[model samples]
Target: MTVFLIWSCSGKNASEISNETLLIVKKIEKINVLMGSAVGSSGHKPNQYENFEELKKNASKQELITLTNHSNGVVRCYSFWALALSENIDLFSIIKDHINDDTQVKTQFGCSGSTEKVGDFFINLVNPKDEDSDITKLTPDEFNKLDSLLIHKENNLYARYDAIANAVPTAYLYSKVREMVVKHNNQNALITLSKYKNPHDIELILKNRDPDEDGESGYFYTYKAIQNFPDPIFLPFLEKKLNETLDNDRYDGEWLQLYMAIASYKNQKSLELLTIPFTKVKHQDIKKYHIKFVYEAIIVNKSKLYDDLLWKIWQDENIITQEGFEYLLQLNKTKTLELSKKELNSNYQIKNTNTIPKINQSMFSQNLEENMLNFVLLNDKVFAYNVINDKIINTNVNDFEMYCSKILELKDPSFTEILFKRLKNEDNPHVYLQIVETLISFKDESINKRILETRKKNKNMNQDWGSEALDEILKKNKIK
Candidate 1:
């Protein structure tokens, strides 16, 4: 074990450990951080749920693989499950054996969700197999270990929790987790969570503890015992949310605690009530949240149900407004991008050259290029640029640079003219600096004209928007 640990730990700094080991370390360190241990004694104050984030950033691909094979079954199980979350089947050949992709059912969670079964995921990778066995397959014994952890009462809380999550891989897990809450005697814990005033918590309590069920006090009492222990009882809560998004049914989970109470307890009829007032939800912000999840619930239909909300939002004088665009951007990027494309293209159906809404088309045309660019800008770019660490920042800075370069590559006469116009006086140093940085990514000297013009403007103005903004832009441009 010592030799193997040393071998896996080689070819790495404390900074560059593989993701598998890093995840294991993260799990252990999270416990340490929670326990206020000396292990993370660098004066770092761990955020409630964020302590493992940095270790996740520093972990490598192979280290994650190694951690999956850790000597401790608990460690192996934890890392095995993490891979299911972070990776698709393609990341490692081993996943292919568990997930056949052809035989799985279309669960409420996603399309062909059966083929991407979480049970198959953990079952295949949990304990691995004979030294001579194929990488794509695992033995029956290996699969059982994962199952036993969930169905068997002997396994610890973490193992049972992760196992059940792997087992159902659906809103069905809600029932299983509820069962576990009882098995684990978590009632007092649950009651405490319910008493909390926050909506997200009250939402969670009402979600996991259904009011309609009478005998649940037994289960509730069990859960209350572990209230202060800080187990992630929210797992099934998150799963219920993602799964109830199956369709634009009357009772998808989007209406807060409504879906949890229904789906977690097998009240299939609740789906009907799930979607009431969607069309009638007139408040822009509330309507936006409804449509965001409603769209997900109806994603299987492509745009059949989406068209309803889209048309209503687009046509309603009261509903269709900029306030909802933020919510729309959060739902499905593919659908939103497609909608933007359609609205931009002359041949596309939704375009309104009539200028009915009086959108800011002249300042920035809603062409595909500009719309997509603005979506990224208004959505994630602010957070990405501000995040100093790789974990929160996403690992693809260069890819983002390339993607932004593609936006700059658009040669539309209007778009190009606007680039030069904005570069000359763009007050947002961050946005302007991003433009300069992205322009150079294309490596085309033709853009040099734009840069030169901006520099000329930068010199003559004798400093406009404070020296800090100038300093920022120059820093991004690496200007002398």
Candidate 2:
């Protein structure tokens, strides 16, 4: 008891401590001491406690009220639950006022609700009666106060949002919520109104769905609203945008969301519209977007109609990458692999012609040299600077391994500097290890000296995967 008192007093003077503050300090001290005792008894932390009921029963109403305002959010949250269990009416106003505190509190499971807003949690505890019923528990004055807060434009966005969301179950302030949705076109208000299945809210969202002068569009939320309501009336607007995107040869960034919204209908008309863009679009970007969404839609709806279309897309060398092929394989492995074999044989043909095919270079050339080096290393390929073609060509192949095999197969000394540079600056430990392992296979005394120097430089610093990699290489080679 004295240890607890001394620890609490050390932080703040007894003269400055209020009765409310002292109560919280004492409660925390008791909990800590109890935890210590439990640890001592069991030699392990106790998950369940036998004294939890006693602890709650002992809490005074006044002290609980005071604890709600405590600097420690966990203490405040515990006080909230205790007051709720005790059915203390006084807690209502205090909980409502502190709804926006935003202090993180931990659950009984020890995970913190850092991402959750406190106001949302407080509103859930209120549990007002259903929409048609009269306010059963709250006084008329308190009920009116909640209604005012729900539509108060000046209040915190989350606070007002929570009020509207919670008010839905009780149907409290329904008219005011509709009015806010229409008048303000507020995103949160629209979301709430959509939940109630109001047709008018859909029209409002479409009417207000224009991009700003800065080309910033709220179509993401607009698409979300349309998905919630799922009205056929909105299909023309969506189709028109899709057509515009196709015509302009550029994406509006919300293309994926729009495509998904269209596919959500799962109807002949919507499916037909979705297939139009996929079949007719030659633009690789548009093709990629369609492939991704179409595959997702097929998986979601379990539709077999798009199987042939996905296979066709997978065969298109310009549209699919190694990663995309892997993803397609996951969706349907047998069909994907069968298609991939045919496509790979044709695409990877080593031609003697000096004419390089006009492919989209931007995709492969962004990190040109680095990407080329990676291709050569990982794909067991070689590049030659063809002066006539004015492009690099894949010239040879060897077995792919990280260590001795890769180093022994390197016919070009030009790549050695590139490998060393990558090894020196590479931050990823696994990659660093691969490079060190490859360099070790060279068995060059000069390279070994450099490796040892690097080891010495990083030795006194933090031991990471990079340092561990160096140790493995040194151990394997029997080097000091």
- Say which candidate scores most in TM-score: 2
lDDT of 2 by residue, 10-32 (tens): 13322233444455455553443
lDDT by candidate, in order shown: 0.40, 0.52
Give the distance in Å from residue 336's predicted Cα in candidate 2 to where it truly belongs: 2.5
Evaluated at residue 322, the lDDT of candidate 1 is 40
Stretches of model 1 off by over 4 angstroms after superposition: 1-144, 168-275, 279-287, 300-404, 411-416, 427-430, 433-450, 459-480
Off by over 4 Å in 2: 1-95, 100-154, 159-177, 195-202, 208-216, 278-302, 317-333, 339-469, 472-480
Candidate 1 per-residue lDDT over residues 204-297, each given as its tens digit: 4534543434421223322332222223454454344434333433432324332233223222233333344454554555555665443333
What TM-score, computed on C-alpha atoms, does each candidate reach? 0.36, 0.44
In lDDT terms, which candidate is top?
2
